[model samples]
Target: MKQVKINRLSDETSAQLQLLTIKDMMSLLCISRPKVYELMQNEGLPFMRMGRSLRFYAASVQRWLIEHEQVRG
Candidate 1:
């Protein structure tokens, strides 16, 4: 298993440090597989390639969501 170095956060947040698979990413973002790939390729979604598989850090993905979130008027 590949290891990811995570910055220390609050206890609750730190506990969530783990790698997420593509399926997990799809579910977490509530999007389709193709869309996830699109985001990874074009939308700057953070990810790492582990051999032939793609992995995402849970906390990083959450932070990305927060950073990318837009307040629609």
Candidate 2:
């Protein structure tokens, strides 16, 4: 099983911070490696580069999901 970190903050900005591996993203988004890279390139998915690695922000991704569902519906 994979693990994600939990955070507590004020009601106005209480967002959990999570670091997902490439493998974890594959499972969560149910997309292939190529697709993930495509989204990273074509779509403005929030991501950060640490050293030589890329990481996504959980809060930003959650916001993206909410927007996606709104558009879909």
Candidate 3:
């Protein structure tokens, strides 16, 4: 299958620290909501809390994946 390379989403989220919710993370990563929450619980993947809600940093998520990526053997 041909892979469609989508440009990485860059935004001024830091100035506003526009943290993304779990729903947004799923869309961004093309993963399930449960998976997104699982990752968040496992690592300190750039998250902040709003009252009782979870919020993740968009840039931090990108960096986190790049930094902690593994190679298949």
Candidate 4:
């Protein structure tokens, strides 16, 4: 997994920030809502449930992306 340093945010959110909403994940991956959901079900996308919403960790998502690309190749 590659290290993801969010240098844009200087506030406290820059550290120990793991959870990301579906919308945020969509933007980072540059994909649509349906595509993200499809990956979640088909691929082993590490995630968590915050009440009724779904969340993903930045590091884990980065790792998953790496694994996904490897699989594609």
lDDT of each: 0.89, 0.74, 0.78, 0.84
Best-to-worst ranking by lDDT: 1, 4, 3, 2
The most accurate candidate by TM-score is 1
C-alpha TM-score for every candidate: 0.76, 0.68, 0.64, 0.70
Q: For model 4, what is the error of residue 71's alpha carbon versus the real structure, in angstroms, after optimal superposition?
A: 8.5
| Candidate 3 vs. true structure, TM-score | 0.64
* Candidate 2 clashing pairs, residues 3+ apart or interchain: none
Model 4 lDDT at residue 65: 82
- Please rank every candidate by TM-score, starting with the best: 1, 4, 2, 3
Model 2 error, position 14 (Å): 8.7
Task: Tell me model 2's lDDT, rounded to 2 decimals.
Answer: 0.74
Clashes of each: 0, 0, 0, 0
Residues 1-73 of candidate 2: C-alpha lDDT, one tens digit per residue: 9998887577545445676766667788999988878777887666778999988867777787676664434
lDDT of 3 by residue, 39-70 (tens): 87786567888899988766677789899899
Q: Which stretches in model 3 have alpha-carbon errors above 4 Å?
A: 1-16
What are the RMSDs of all candidates, in order? Answer: 7.9, 8.7, 11.9, 10.1
lDDT digits (tens) for residues 1-73 of candidate 4: 9998765875556544668999998899899999889899999888889899999978788878887785434
Q: Write the number of the candidate with greater lDDT, choosing between 1 and 2.
A: 1
